[model samples]
Target: MSVVPAEVLPGGARAVTGTVRATVTAELGPRARLWPSLVAVYRAQLSRARVARIPLLFVATFQSVGILIMMRGVVDGGSEAESVVAGSAVLVVAFVALNLLAQYFGQLRASGGLDHYATLPVPPAAVVLGAAGAYASFTVPGTLVTAVFGCVLFGLPLTHLWVLAAVIPLAGAALSGLGAAFGLLAPRPELATVLGQLGMSAALLLGVLPPDRMPEAVRFARDLLPSTYGVEAFARTFGADPDWALVLGDLAVCAGVGVVSLAVATWAYRRAAVR
Candidate 1:
């Protein structure tokens, strides 16, 4: 019997074995911490979103502005004006955080983009939160512009506009998570787009239109919508003697809903990624 050298056991055998070992080692490697992974993903998504930032900002601003203009005829001032302005501002948030995000993740999943993320040593929660945060960040400019413009158009007090500081993130977090969940859970990309559009339309109708104008049943539906609380919180601040307590309560509801929605989104991400 002839003894064969280990290196010559088979053609390319050692190289193949080494490659397999490397792959397994990589697969078994420790993942980056959640916060770092979140930051990295946020940066990457932010960069990607920047490419189309102009159109998105334009659409968000223009849509809100146009709504304000139309409402100008019907609503002269007072609580009606407050609702319109606040609703329009949050509408910008809904456009980016809810609408665009849904489309993005839907496309991502449909194109097998989740596979790329799955290969990375990153937590699934980070992926969901990072994407949501990136999208939410885009809402700021549009929301500010809308709020300022709506205030000018409706002649509402700008002193309380600072309330948006609390409103944006809370509303954005809630809506972004809902958008991400919608995208990941949808069976098809087209369905996700449709759902996103419908959601925005609901926000426009239920949020922008004064609750007083809505039927009792419709008002109840509006109450069920997460964005409504954010809108209410912002709207209340426009008053001369604003109720800080009520504003805080509304914001608290928004924060609570945000947590729930984001949790759902993380769950959806894990479910979708495995497929």
Candidate 2:
């Protein structure tokens, strides 16, 4: 029998191919760190959302403004007015962060977008947090406008309006994570949209209306909703002698819920990406 060259042997060819693949992989560099990946994803999502969601942002602002106008008739002033204003401002956050984000991820899932994200070297948490942060950031302008307009309409003090600096991100984190979970967990895009709408409605009814006006059962339900803490924290600031302790407590609770919800969303994202 004739001796074959090593290059022509099957095992040698396999080894050569493996070596080439390894070299190529090494040249590609290490996987990205979480912070850099997060920032890059955030920038991409922000730009895309800016162009595509501007109309929805308008709708959110207009919707909040309209609610304030309607409630102005029923609630002249006082704590009830504060509730309406605060809840409505936070509602803008809910509309985009909770409602729109659900729709976005739902569509992404339906369209094989998760596969694209999975192909990237970024951490799953980076993807979830980045998208959530981008959507949440959109709420800032609409939220501020609603708060300022509502304060004027309700004759509430503008002094503590600055508290929203804390309120928006905390509340947005909670709501955005919830929205992302809803979207990723839903079996269908339609179901995701429905869940988002229902969430927003809950915020509208339970958060905007004063807790005192609710029945015991409804009040309990409101307490379960994360956005209520944000509404309460913000509404308290309108008081002449605002309870800083209570406000901080509410904010702390909101922050805690945000962390929990975001962790859940990250879990949901990982689960969905695998499929």
Candidate 3:
């Protein structure tokens, strides 16, 4: 604290003495790097949501499995069966990555949870990606189970099931980012929930069904969805002679979409955090 003479007025008359106090701001350490911050947030989110996500994961798996069972009677082994199996597998990803993630972020935003994260030193992208990755992680077991069950139910060859290694991350990235954007951008949490449900419903209707049976307009709409590329990549593997090039092409599309969507989600995270 210090004492100072008051400034003279416009009339050249000095005022009274003044006291001043200086604030010594504490310097924070350097911000965490992207990878390390991402990992930290990922671990925190993963550990925190493990128990809560298990039951929802079970439901996702069971729902996909039930779809497989129903489709079993409708479609004997063929391309249709391949489509059904692939779609059912990716549907697990959609359920957790898209639907539940949207709900999570919506609730977080509504409850001022973003404020806590906003105060952290982590990048907004890391926060968004970390949460998305954790929620997506919960879908792995469900996806695998659904895929295996679908294969067995439809008599599809399991030789290329390993392609799931690529499909999961790519598709999860795309869906989770979209979910986060929806949650963060929505004016209300309930609206966010509706958007998530609508997105999942679109996945279920457009993805699980055989595209050939769909109207031309509907097929066009299917082409726009990111998860459908993953489904296509996975379904292509079920053929007696798999087209590796086409499979890779579909995966590439998914990868591209994932990158774009996640970037958009990061932007949304920033926008939401500032508010």
| Each model's backbone clash number | 0, 0, 0
lDDT of 2: 0.94
- Model 3 regions lying over 4 Å from their true place: 1-18, 21-26
Give per-residue CA lDDT, model 2, range 1-275, as digits (tens): 77987668766545455445544333675887899999999999999998899999999999999999999889989889999999999999999999999999999998899999898888999999999999999999999999999999988889998999999999999999999999999999999999999999999999998788689999999999999999999999999999999999999988999999999999998999997
User: Candidate 2: which pairs clash?
Assistant: none
- The best candidate in terms of lDDT: 2
List CA RMSD, all candidates: 5.6, 5.4, 5.5
What ranges in model 2 sit over 4 Å off?
Answer: 1-28
Please give each candidate's TM-score: 0.90, 0.90, 0.92
Q: Lowest summed lDDT over 10 consecutive residues: which window, candidate 2?
A: 17-26
Pairs with steric clashes in candidate 3 = none
Candidate 3, residues 1-275, lDDT tens digits: the string is: 34544554354564543564565899888897899999999999899778687888889999999999998888987899999999999999999999998999899999999999888888998999999999888888999999999988887888999999999999999999999999998989999999999999999989999999898999999999999999999999988889999999999998898889899989988999987
Candidate 1 lDDT over residue span 25-62, tens digit each: 34467868999999999999899889877697898899
Name the lDDT value of residue 4 in candidate 1: 77
